[model samples]
Target: MNKSSGPDKNRMDVKKLVSIGIAFTLFFIAQGNILTVTDGGYSPSPKLCSTLKLVPILSLLCVVILVFVLIKMLKHKYVHFKNRELDSKTGSNGLSSMQKDNERKRPAGAKNKTIGMGTDVIKLFQQMKDDISEENTLTLGYRHLLDLACEHLDFSAGVIFIIDHNGCISLRGYSGIIPNSQENYTLELKGIVSELFERNMPRFIRDINSIPGNCQELFYGFKAAWLLPLMPQGFPVGLLIFFHKDVPKHREEYYPKLDFVNIAACWFYENHRNNRIVACENRKIEMLIKTSLAISSSLSLDDVCRILVSDIGKSFGCSYSYLLLSRGRQKEMYVQQCYSERKTPVFEPEEKIIDIENMTWLKEIIAFETPVLLGSEEIKGYPQKDKDILKISGSAGVLIAPLKHNKRLVGILVLVEQRSAERARMGKEVLDLCTALIAQASAAIENARLYSSLSDKVAQLTTMVNVGKALNSDLTLLSFFERVLDGISRNFKIQNCAILLRDFEKDELYVVSVIGHYQEDALNKRFKIGKEGITGRAAALKKTINVDDVSKDDMFIPSTGNTGSEMAIPVILNGEVVGVLDVESEDKYAFSKREEILLSSLMNQVAVAMEKIKLKQLDKERANKLSLTNTLVKKLSGTLDQSDLLANAV
Candidate 1:
């Protein structure tokens, strides 16, 4: 051991010697001091007894000193442990009473607005963790954080100014400014906030004069101002500005609490931002999965289209949606599938035909054919009448993503809705959904093409059967036409029905039948095949027209019982249109898929009946001639009169 350690050793030696001396003296006393005497049996003298008592008292005093030393060692151990945790936990190893008292008494703001700054400081950090857990988006994280600060702190007003990639400070949200007024201050708040953020540090100013003139003069005038870096390294992500009457001026006594709060602030932004990013990634994965499922699970084109549009809209929170497709060889765009939200939905007809240019958004969407997005300004371009309709239908903005697939533009989709900032963020998911719908639409078109070809073969077979029946049965032309017309019209759900057949000898088409809610013009009107009127026109062109709105259709002639919609299908025999089956409806686009097939069926029957009737007339003529010739032969054999035989033939 070193010489310096000797004093401590000597002190230990003295204590050991004192203990031995005290023990020896006690033993000597107990053995009895050499005295005897009176009433008690052989007791030591008072002097010896007093010496023993003194030893025990001194020993007890020494024990007390050892205990004091042990206590000191234990206290030193406790202090060491507390120092580490306090520094890491609070960033401040020691805090003065006044600082702690002030923190407890006041959080962030005035009495009425108790920011519960302490509570909020903790909550904000907690919120950062939750946001990171969701992994939705940094923007969302910023919103929640700003809200928590403004709400918990009793500041008169507050704002979160964010530093963008361009190193510019931009005001994101404000609790005090009217929502409408937010735009005015966005650019104005940029300069100073940006400079402060560039400094990459925290600053608290009680009055404007405390700050350097140019940098914080404007900020200082705001009563109390606090700026905290969103990130630790000084590249600012965001900053909070508080205007509060309750906050005491920042001073040395209050620095520790400030230190803790600032540390928490930076952590809040970083963690929350990271969480949002993760959430965004997860959402993208989910959408990809859903898109794949929709394409595989649905079979029919219409079903797939409906599913694609609706799921995307709901998943993305869009209020209204529908699909538009090109129809016929002319590529006329019309509404194919339509749906809307339960709370708010689009109300346009399922079959809207667009022609010319700029008639409405429907036409504009077709023109662009790309994803055309529209907000209030774009939607306002609609006609005053349409605008009124749009308002009632809860549409102020819209986005139309064309169902473009396979390099062959298939269709367009219209999504109309109203939304808030938060709600709009939710809508990004819907945008992706539009891409999935494009594939489903192409499959649908192919399916439709197959169904059309199959329906044609059925029509041909049906025509042959109907012709045989008409020739075999001797029903009057009017009665036969009525049964055929009614069957076709009723099946197609046509509100009005009329048939015009060609007159071979007259070289004209005349009304062969009419069955409807409205009366016909004397029921005997006739016209050349290529003349005016829908029936005549159909015969002229040998085509079909399924017009949704008769009033809007130039081909339609005015009639009674509100003829809002109409269709004309030509009946052909021997590669020529012999007649036309005309139908009308009080409702626009009344012909669904099932209804259209019914019209074709009725037209098939008419074509067959016409062919059968013509054949029967020839057969009857042949039979009559045969009978005349037989009778003449019998007469001639008996009378030998050639002139009589000829007369008999007639």
Candidate 2:
């Protein structure tokens, strides 16, 4: 029936052919009685017997040929069947092997696809790495990152936000059509961003309507958004947001691709952070250099203060800045200089003396020798005086940095932040910078003060030396006094000056020499020591007395015209006050410590010169008396009259 059964039918046909040949030989032998040949050895059956033998031989010949043909046909059929069976088995095995091969190749194809994706990611990373290396500024780096992200990730628009020290995010860089009102958008999304940042995960919003109604407008034209938190050191330092106007094809691919983008964003954040640190350090160095130059360029305290305040204000972008310097032995603080952005009048009254000890915050700052930052809200709770001061400054935030030199508080630097939100976020970095700047400025200020003091002292000594030279020359007592008075009036710029000599026997002070508008009235004036005016007081006490306002001073007896200020220095020789040097002025607070010291020095020279003049007068008078005695004795000896000699001696 089938090809596989064809070999069996062929074998049956061969057997039938053998059987028919044998039957033909048997019939012919029976008909001709060829088997009777055994008995016909004696009797011959002539033509029939011969014909039967011939028939038997012919049948045998036919049977042999048929058998040969059958054998050949059977062999050929067997070979064909064996070949067909082998082919059939081979075909079946081939089918199964092909299926197994396909199964084996499927995973290889997937592996190749995965490898290709990985290769692309690696290439992108390399590209970004190059960008990081080439970019010199943080802005440029951020821009490059945004551009790369949009190009590779199929983002229509993107924005990058950096977190400030106060944990507020502000837009730093962007690409594509970011609206100008993005600040409002950012504010609205701050809550969502905070949650996502806290979770440290990326979020994909597929539907714009899913967002809050108020925030939905931010993504009006965008069909989707990918919010990727840029976490460095497991803390959110920034965020990278990508938006799409329409859903991207092969959207499933974006999920895996986002991993690469996340890695890239982290790199970008790290790079930007490093750049900011370097830039900040550079800025600090530059500011220090400029400040040093500005401070050193001038020797005047006013100039130094102005430069310091201006430089600090510009550096920090502050609205107001001022410097408070400590003065007097009591260490009272005073506002030395002030600067403000607004032209409005000051809100608080000016204070001539600041009681720093009464202000707890200022005392703390000085005691700790550290800076203090105050907010407007906290300032409201402070003392009334301090509260008024801050309110007058119009500051939302304030920084007070103490200026110290050699462990002593020299001054305080006050910076006021009015409108800048950026300045309000000053952290440790800003504090450190301010500390360094203040340290340098303090040193400069201290040096300037020391130099000015030394210069004044030198000038005073020079003046004293010149006065000594003039007084030591050959001059009479009256001439010497007049020269000293002239020198004092010229050098000190005092219009009213007088020298009062102590009359020890009378226990009183009398004006020996006077040079002023009331010279005639004051020259012979007399007053009791230890009981009268400033001059008497100085002689009795053997010290200097300075009066800022002679009219207000109880010890002042204003006799030398309407004197407003006065200074009296006692002239001492051999530990005893011999006289008093008195100088007066028509202006209040006219005498400084330096002037007082200089006057005392000049008075010492005058006292020494006066003592020398007195000794010279005594020598001249003795010589005249000795010469008179010798002349009288010579005249008496020549006359030889005892009575006359006695009269001359008497």
lDDT of 2 by residue, 1-650 (tens): 12212345556767787798689768756665434455446333465555666777788887887787778667666655654574353222111221222223322233223224644665675576567557765556777878887887678988777675445465666787554542333333345676766666567778766543244554568888887677766776777778888877554455445555665566656665677678679869987997787566647666778778776776666777888887754247766667776744333333423556667766776777777776555555677776564343445577888888988888888887765332353445667788778788898778767766776666566666655665556667767777777867775668988888889999999887778876456766888888899888888888999987776677788766678888999989999998888889887767767688778877887788788887877777899889879989798769988888888777
Shift in Å, residue 632, candidate 1 = 8.0
Return the TM-score for each candidate structure.
Answer: 0.57, 0.47
- Name the TM-score of candidate 2: 0.47
lDDT digits (tens) for residues 102-133 of candidate 1: 34444333221212234445445445445533
- In candidate 1, how many clashes are counted? 8
Which sections of candidate 2 miss by over 4 Å? 1-355, 358-360, 367-370, 385-397, 415-433, 476-499, 502-542, 549-565, 573-577, 583-606, 617-650
Clashing pairs in 2: none
List the global CA lDDT of all models.
0.57, 0.68
